[model samples]
Target: MSLPRQLLLGAAALSLAGFAQADIAIEMHAVDKSGVGKTIGKVVASQSRYGVVFTPMLKGLSPGLHGFHVHTNPSCEPAEKEGKVVPALGAGGHYDPESAGRHGFPWGDGHLGDLPALFVNDGGTADSPVLAPRLKLPDLEGRALMIHAGGDNYSDNPKPLGGGGSRVACGVVKSAPK
Candidate 1:
């Protein structure tokens, strides 16, 4: 019944309400030059104290670290790049609305869509959650989530996009239905 206690409760309630409004679930799938394949699982994206947390429930991926990112478009279909078909190329490049034009850490001054690498266990499942401190729920809309075929070094040296190689999996982040 104390005033301080009431203020604390009020703040907690407000935080929860804000988070509830910003949550989204993106369905992930295997992708290749053929296009999006069977459903792998889903990623539950939510707001946390530090930033947005992406908890994936994916499976059937190769073991080791894989590059993860938010691409500029919201489609997972394959597209023609040069003379070759690139899977998930319809998703465009990494979300760099500011024109950073380079790859960096999740909290660095580069692509706003840069995210921490995802780790796949030996059993071929990616259940570990990763954080993108520079991202929020609103930044995800009208974009696509991409998983690369290789690990990310978080640098542009000697390779582009952290040498993540090909796009192995993808998911589109659609707006919440009314």
Candidate 2:
């Protein structure tokens, strides 16, 4: 093969390889007790030397602490749960592949999908960045990112799953651009 042609092909291959490790982003949308389907914000996730960094650019929130986690499924459609139709039930439980059935802090040994709480400003928007040391870029693919209506206590004692009542917003984790 010609030297110039060989060098060009090699560079192209390297570019393609970078795509496989590209960061992931989730386009968060609005949802309510009524059902699901509304675009509101976005959550971009990327891996760093420390861990997975979650940068959320959200708007139209309730202006408080919202529980955020990675759910098992990719669907954000409303579905019935325990005989009642809950918002984003189609996304399934917290992304607990091990069936841990436990809820705790993101740093603890519980549901692997647990993440840091999201804080929204008085203007009903959140643009802060949070990190999860236990998460990786590939761990979020095909999963659903859900934001609860209330704050997360990071415990299962009085209420389940940090007492973050109701799934209010969600987005599906998809591949990022190269």
| Top of the candidates by lDDT | 1
The numbered model that scores best in TM-score is 1
lDDT of 1 at 140: 91
In model 2, the runs with Cα more than 4 Å from the true position are: 1-22, 176-178
Residue 129 lDDT, candidate 1, scale 0-100? 68
lDDT per residue for candidate 1 within 63-178, as digits (tens), equals 99999999999999999988999999999999998999999988789999998888899999987667677787889988999999999988998899999999999999887432
Which TM-score value belongs to model 2?
0.83
Q: What value does the lDDT take at residue 6 in candidate 2?
A: 42
lDDT of each: 0.84, 0.78
Sliding window of 10 residues with minimal summed lDDT for model 2: 13-22
Stretches > 4 Å off in candidate 1: 1-22, 176-178
Clashes of each: 0, 0
Alpha-carbon RMSD, candidate 1: 7.8
Task: For candidate 1, list the clashing residue pairs, or say none.
Answer: none
